[model samples]
Target: MGKLTIVAHIKAKADKIDLVKSELLKLINTTRAESGCINYNLHQDNSNPAHFLFYENWESRSLWQTHMNNKHLEDYMKATEGAVDEFVLNEMAEIDS
Candidate 1:
């Protein structure tokens, strides 16, 4: 199977940007340590402080699925409830060169 690439766009509620940022930051270390993780990076938009993005690469779709069901991720979802205004997650595969 091919590697899985994920692009996640997250928007924080105006009043809750700090809270959302903190929660998202907490995922970095843990996610990087997960099995089959190739890379997990987080970014903030220069033009919009409330806008955030994550770029993640995993060995396979099954590993990515494990990441989605991780306990820490579940806690993050609960903690960010209502603090996040929008979230879009996209999964992709690299095209052979």
Candidate 2:
């Protein structure tokens, strides 16, 4: 099995930027501790404060799937219900070199 990479772009509603950011930040610590997590980093766009991106690497697709079902993620989903304006998730596999 090969490693998987995930690029997630999140945009918070204008009025809920702060609340959405706080909720997203909470996923960092917990996600980093999960099994098979190689690296999970979050970034905020300087020009657009409400725009955020997450770059993640996983040992395998299954492990990444497990992460999606994690309790904290579910909680985040619930907590940010309408606060998010757009969410784009992309999964990729490295090409043989």
Candidate 3:
């Protein structure tokens, strides 16, 4: 209904951080171009080479769902099926802000 914010914490396979970054960044760029996207960004952990995070904002839950079903996103997921070792996706809403 309201805005949806998605936070994704991922850990690439050993020594595959760069590969994951490249692919994930491409998907994030494409997601930013989507009609309902509010913002999209990727961040790396300072101490952990294999850890990365994706922060994304969308107009609504429905729009976020659409982004999840995007062709490019699907392709990215397929490509990283084996390359990715761990993933944690969290969704949220701003309670007061």
Q: What is the C-alpha lDDT of each candidate?
A: 0.95, 0.96, 0.88
The per-residue C-alpha lDDT of model 3 at residue 25 equals: 80
Candidate 1: tens digits of C-alpha lDDT, residues 1-97: 7899999999999999999999999999999999999999999999999999999999999999998999999999999998998999999988984
Give the root-mean-square deviation of each candidate in angstroms: 0.9, 1.1, 1.0
Model 1 lDDT-worst window of ten: 88-97
Clashing residue pairs found in predicted model 1: none
Per-model TM-score versus the true fold = 0.96, 0.95, 0.93
lDDT of 2 by residue, 1-97 (tens): 7899999999999999999999999999999999999999999999999999999999999999999999999999999999999999999877865
Off by over 4 Å in 2: none
Better of 1 and 2 by lDDT: 2
List candidate 1 stretches off by more than 4 Å: none
Predicted structure 3, TM vs. truth: 0.93
* Most TM-score-accurate candidate: 1
TM-score head-to-head 1 vs 2, winner = 1
